[model samples]
Target chain A: MQIQSISLSDSLILTLLTLVIYQSAAWAQQKSKFIWLNPLLVTIIVLIPFLLLSKIPYANYRLSTHFLNALLEPAIVALGYPLYLQLQHIKRNWKLLVAILVLGVILVVTLSFSLTMLLIHQKEIAIALSLKSVTTPVGIIITEQLQGDSSITPFAIIIAGFAGGLLGPSWLRFLKIRSDIAAGLSIGAASHVIGSMIISKDNPYQGAYSSVALIICAVLTAFIMPLLMPILSVFFA
Target chain B: MKDIIYTVLTITLCLVLGKLINFSVSGLPASLYGMIIYCLLLQLGLVKPIKVHKTNQWAIKHMGVCFIPAAVGVINHFELIQNHGLTIIGIIFFTTFALLTFVAVLAEKYLANKSESSPSTSNC
Candidate 1:
């Protein structure tokens, strides 16, 4: 995939550029009471257009920003610290949490797949939509495995994340779902890290549950999607 | 300086172990494995939390920044979004909201009942 090698200086500059933009967006989010000024969303919006206008290929941008991407794995590992902190809470409710997560995965995949197939009738997009609730890397990988349009997978994931981050807390509140575990699990299961991050600011306990949900949903979707897609396809047809 | 090195080594060890497991098991991400492994290590007292505390905190706090590159990759698929943007958005919105409601309602009911039955277990 490395079609053209980016120079060392260019890569460094791009890396620094991403950090600056991301930090600024994060700062904006911190100062303002708006949800749309999400750091990840803002960074993507600003960088995409900047790259396009500058006639820079997406490949170059990706290559330049590879350092940030490399940190993703460690960032994921970092999540374990919070999960560890919440171990007692998780242990107490493992059975219930597992039951909810498994059910949530089935519910999300079925709803998304059926809706996409019913409306668009495109198998690839349907497959991508079914896995959008999981983290981006897992979703993309599963989408590819299911013969979906992998390119659309990330976009779908971001939209799902944004939707969950923006509306999840308020929606849950309106419904009077006051349990931190419930809020965290639902948001984490449906929105992944984005929702988890947003909720964590309000309550760390909710964030921990959200991260737990994120990990479990990712694993469940990876294993279940491959087996379930064929069955869903048959049912849809 | 010593703390930073210790943190790096601990995380790297987990990542390497995760990668090794991933080599054998072909589905889940190595990072996911690393997360579980890291948690287990903490549980077993194999890795001291204080050693990795600073790094882990910083990483988790700013984790959103790491995802920007991949999200921007979406730009490559403008045609896909242009073609089915509304339908796709609708499906995502509907399904996400439905799942959120379903999970939250069910979980909330179960949790409330549990707390009522055993008040001691109710932390929040």
Candidate 2:
């Protein structure tokens, strides 16, 4: 468990390996009808064991794939394309959309925060848990702001995203929630981009709403969490 | 080729602007700022859709790939996971399910009625 410095050539090889595995996972997801075959989930399932067996430290893998991580910023910015396309719908029902997302953000934060505090009773873990529903970047930022363990935030986020991607649609169907708008917003708000990405493949309209939910929820969580954390901390304290 | 270049430059420019804004204001991620700025640019006609179309599509389509590195980093926290893994997973799963049900059920009620009252807006 010594952290080792990776060579540039090794980094390049790791980066290439991630891409190859990712592309294969993506293909498998597309080819398979199973909802659980999400590309991100599959990639993680394969890479974690691969890293463990190969004796490659997670730090080395992360550094090697830093370029890909950098692309995440641009990828998030690129989400604006879908957001732009959905402008008409967003504009028409912005008030309702905002209201729902605002309430949704508050609900998720409160629920996660209280549940973690009640069960785990660890304030740092609770703080990290509170922001799990938002995108990774936003979650990380808020986790740091609240003096929580930022490392735990991403893991919680990926799990939340994985759950949302795997079971969100089917769960919605079981609940008989048929509206694409509702489905998309809930998936996006609850699961973030990963869930929305999966839903979007089935219906672009839902995807658009999902992105809208994703962005709005991110903004709202950023605003709400700081103010709300102190208040919620009182209950647990 | 030109369009691709424009797309790259435009997204990079937006990200840089976002970082600047985040530096000054703080709170939100630079990427979120970049998204807002990019969305505004598209809305204001400063940036056209076609220019960024291909790149945006590719990025969104493969956005999951970008998260691999971060997710893999979770392996580093095995000790924490081992300590509270089941509780953590339970909280996430339950809360996420509750949030989804809460939002979706309410949204369905609101949207279903809205569409019924104003069928014209229902098409989207």
Global lDDT of each model? Answer: 0.79, 0.80
Pairs in clash, predicted candidate 2: none
Error of 2 at A58 (Å): 2.2
Candidate 2 local lDDT, A181-234, one digit each (tens)? 888789889898778767777887777677778767877887889889889999
**DockQ for candidate 2, C-alpha atoms:** 0.49
* Span of 10 residues, lowest total lDDT, candidate 2 chain B: B115-124
Docking class of 1: acceptable
Q: lDDT tens string, model 2, B55-96? A: 778767777677777667678778878888999999999999
Specify the highest-TM-score model's number: 2
Q: Candidate 1, residues A1-237: lDDT per residue as tens digits? A: 445778999999999999999999989988895667877778878888898899888889888888987887777676666667655456667788778888889989988999898988899889988988987766765675568876577778888988997799999999999887788779989998778777877887777677777877877787678777778889878
Report chain A TM-scores, every model.
Answer: 0.76, 0.78
Error of 1 at B5 (Å): 1.9
Backbone clashes in model 1? 0
Fraction of native A-B contacts kept, per candidate = 0.61, 0.62
Question: Is model 2 an incorrect, acceptable, medium or high docking prediction?
Answer: acceptable
